[model samples]
Target: MISLTSPVETRAHHWRAGIKLGALCASTLILFFIQNWLFQSAFLALVIVLYLLPGWRFFTHGLKPIKMLWPFIVLVGAWHWWSNELQQGAIIILRLLSMVALANLVTMTTRLSDMIEVVRFLTRPFAKMGFNTRALEIAMALVIRMTPVLIGKGQKLTWAWKARSHRRSGWRILLPFTVLALDDADHVAEALRARGGLTNND
Candidate 1:
């Protein structure tokens, strides 16, 4: 497995990868706006081509996360199907799938350090608006670090519930995860403050 902890070199590499991913996303959205069947077909075909080509890295993660998100995906698909005309529904679903694939590509290829730098630079221009770039950076870092842990915790909670054959719904799974997430976030915030990660004075 490639080490996700290691950093990538240069801002330009980040920009290039981001641009490629963004362009694909933008084009798909544009196609959806036109709401034409031909454009949807073409975009879907291109997505298939992109998936088959090596080094795309998005599909390389290999469907597990997509599988995990299937329930939400189906719910959204149903909403689109019922709320729109047939042509519009098809376009909406295709656009959504394309955007999702591109997002996965961005996360798979982009390094954590580069992502942080991009966030820092992107937020620096907003300093004049009284925004604290340091806080934002720390927040992003915490999110990146804690997201996987949170997901793992949720998965464990689900498994435990299933093992007990409980038919509980909604907050039965959510309340504990929310409490655990909050406690974890509080600990992270304390650790960062101890390290002076939130200092305003440079």
Candidate 2:
């Protein structure tokens, strides 16, 4: 499996995963309380600067994940425009982009194992209450790991559709994408079973 963790090491990589995650949560919460677009824009700029602190190559690599948000950005912009609430829309878009960028930054720097351990620590209380959190942990890890894979697959499907047909490939790709996701899920399930699944004892 291709690792989502960036190969280009930065100072942020040396930071503890728990601290990075805690900061992300706190920053995200504070973002919601701020309603000014200028403030939001400044925050976004600060995030971009933080990304650049890792050097040019790492900064550019960090941006690749943000491209996935273009669709949501466009949709939100359109809705706000239609409602004649452009300022509100801009604030929303900026907030969303900033939060996602911060999250991507954390994921790019932190190792998967570290993030998983943090999650396990967070869920310890629930686990003590007779709730099985092993599956939940596995599911969270899988979702984080598979998101980029699915996005790449969708992009490839779009390109293939474009190559074979002159017409624009729109919703037509959804069926194949769904099938591809299901196929991948089946393979993952098989692999997990072979490895004894995610049993609590394991």
Candidate 3:
């Protein structure tokens, strides 16, 4: 099993792995947006192949966690069945699934530090544009890192509420989530200030 002694180290590892995967995903997404055909097919094929990676069984790993949303998917499928040709609908659905799976893989394998460096380097050329690369990098890193934490918190909160037989009330749960999330945001802002993140004026 993969083991890490600290959250920072874990996040750093994730950042690196994520940047590599995210690069591909981001590039493909852009090409799709721009209708670029040069490598779109290749990227789509890569998306399919990535599903065959270790621990990526669609029915087991992908579907199981989000099984609660199966009804929604079925409803979408039915709607597609009615409103459009099945062939076109199939392509859209498959593309959506591929994008989601690729994103999951990137986030799962990447660390926040890796994301920070990627953003920093990407923004380096913008120093002349008055963009604070450090601040942007830190913000992006924190946002990426918080996603998993927020999900984990939501799950734990749901479980605790269920154990106490609470009705999954929104206000009570949202209170803690909002508070903790704000605290994390504040911490990130302080860290940025300490590091002189806004160095664009210099």
Candidate achieving the largest lDDT: 2
Which 10 consecutive residues of model 3 have the lowest summed lDDT? 1-10
Please write out the lDDT profile of model 3 over residues 62-82, one tens digit for every residue. Answer: 333333445656777788899
Task: Give one digit per residue, the lDDT tens place, for model 1 in 20-137.
Answer: 5457558756865777767777876786665545443534443334455566667767886787766666666666666665554455456666667766667767766777777876
1 versus 2: better TM-score goes to: 2
When sorted by TM-score, best at the front, the candidate numbers are 2, 1, 3
lDDT of 2 at 83: 100
Instruction: Choose the strongest candidate by TM-score.
Output: 2
Look at candidate 1 and tell me the lDDT of residue 9: 35
Give Cα distance to truth, residue 35, candidate 3, Å: 11
> What TM-score would each prediction reach against the true structure?
0.72, 0.94, 0.59
* lDDT value, candidate 1, whole model: 0.62
Model 3 bad stretches (over 4 Å): 1-27, 30-51, 55-92, 109-111, 166-172, 194-197, 200-202
Candidate order, lDDT descending: 2, 1, 3
